[model samples]
Target: MKGQLILLDHLTGPDGPVEAAALMRDGRLEDLFIDSDAPRPGAIYRAKADRPVKGQGGMFLTTPDGPAFLRQVKGLSPGAPLLVQVTGHAEPGKAIPVTTKLLFKSRYAIVTPGAPGINVSRQIKDDETRDALLEIAHDTLDGHPIHDHEGGLILRSSCAEAEGDAVAEDIAAMADLAVQVLNDAEGEAEKLTEGDGPHAMAWREWVTPAQIETEAGCFAHHGVHEKIEALFRPEVALGSATVFIEPTRAFTAVDVNTGADTSLAAGLKANLALARDLPRQLRLRGLGGVVILDLAPMPKKDRRSFEGALRAALKTDDTDTVMAGWTPLGNYELQRKRARQPLTDIVTEEMLQ
Candidate 1:
């Protein structure tokens, strides 16, 4: 959520949907971007509830995908129709989480049925840009439909570089979807529309952010579709540093290799670059929970500065990340609660039936 979420302009096949990838500031993958799809997280589905398990305080709802758990627990009964927003997908032994508080996400905003003002992402650290986006949000409220929705647009970082027209387009789309959310909430409709406009694009496959050239890289082969396929790769080389990422059952560990340059300055330099890119890699790969960075050796004082850079790098990460401090052995510890499935899980049999 902290990155620039853009749909790759290229289509995989004739009449295919565009691919979407969420990229961090340093341009690393955040998650597999599926713009609009049924059964995905954040999707709203109309379902019918079975009787609540009185002891468990929640009931199972039959959705188009399958049975899901509705945890709000009140006023729900067998055969009751409900409009539920999927909070998460079905895990190994865990039921998918759904709620009545419907959420609609557009390119520039998050529309919900609660508050009535715009809120920008704090990651948009540039004061002027933030102010500009806010002004744009305010403008949307001037006779805009759905302007009355409680949770206003929480501008994504991409809004920082967006032209006024782009922001307006998103606001317009939000307004359109806001109406659906309201209608659904008021029982006038049981369906929720994501939106229509530039942000409501569809995609059939997910490619690495590395594959799509932003204002950055590009490709072509035998007049064929081509891209730098690194979205699922776990290691990256930066200047004199090579960071290796290993995700385990308990935590994700990242090790920095200085590659024969063991001098203090070399180690510090490599660690510095790693510190900056490590957070990008972590967020890119969704390596949440108990992350330990095994950095190139640096003095205690130097590690303090290194830690500062790493923290600075992490500022761009919107996840609930807590820095657990460095150990005496020069390894750094941090915890970013997993928000989505890690790339390894998606690439492996974890998601398989």
Candidate 2:
């Protein structure tokens, strides 16, 4: 019962900070008490300086270790897009960015705009998706301009010796976890009252298909189109407000502004809403590290009531989130486990706009 447990999944992000179990033994959940300071384990590679070879577009470097190093890069596939740090003496003291090519020997996955190696063909199972994948692949891999495809690729992991159905199962499990997290957060938020902050909100509006087409056409003409258009679906639009629940290397600072129409009653109502809603957003966002929240400053009496409400909100999040007392500057500090990249990074820019 005290042994270490390492859950591996290809679909899981590069950082596996979130862990769940059916039971906890003597306060040790899954034989590991989640620590905010502990670093997540995954394979990381950096380009070596000596392996430089100049090309027409720019200079590039090959991993001298050959197929073995390439294998390592492929192994990290489906986790997070590989983070490649470019370094060279191009401008003496300055570093030059280089392009990389990730070769996946297993599956011929298509490279999407934001998500590089995401297999749109496999996911959509449609002709348009397949064609898009192939077109992008051929262009990036064998186009006239000689494109650089150096990034993360998904290949079988030699360390785990995972193969056949086992690898597929691992990928499925990771997807399940991600789905479960989202679903559970949504379900929990629905139980709260309107005065309880908006863990999630939906707005309904009537719009003709023609209106959509016209707007989309306008954006497309401007050379601005997003791959993930589902998020923009006007059908019962879902909006959720999240706070920086955790602090990592990049600190999260939230500014709370009292709305123009807010009254004394509405102000207290909003504060209570934020208190109930903030924790859920933190979990949903997967925000880790240090989070600073600037709530609309209230009277001394209201502050005491707000503190209790805030503490209650923190309990809703399944993740190990801790609410530190408010700072002298009227900001409150909280900590959540940093798992994957922020939601803003995950969503498309056009959808955000």
**1-353 per-residue lDDT for model 2 (tens digits):** 23322221111123542221111222222111111212111211233322222242233222222111222122232222222322111221223332233121222221211223433323335575455444444443342211232222232212122233533443333333222322332211121111100111000001011111222233233222231232122121112222223334566655554455356665556567677666645543445667787766577678878889987776544456677777888777777555433443434443324
Residue 288, candidate 2: C-alpha displacement in angstroms: 2.0
lDDT of each: 0.61, 0.35
Off by over 4 Å in 1: 1-38, 47-62, 67-84, 87-93, 97-102, 119-169, 185-235, 318-320, 327-330, 337-340, 344-353
Residue-by-residue lDDT tens digits, candidate 1, 223-322: 1121124535667788867878888877788888888676768888988998777765665565677988898866677877887888898876556778
- TM-score for each predicted model, relative to the true structure: 0.65, 0.32
Q: What is the lDDT of residue 42 in candidate 2?
A: 21
Task: Please give the lDDT score at residue 267 for candidate 2.
Answer: 53
Itemize residue pairs with steric clashes in candidate 1: 114-150, 115-150, 115-151, 116-150, 213-217
Candidate 2's C-alpha runs over 4 A off are 1-249, 347-353
Give the TM-score comparing model 1 with the true structure, all chains together: 0.65
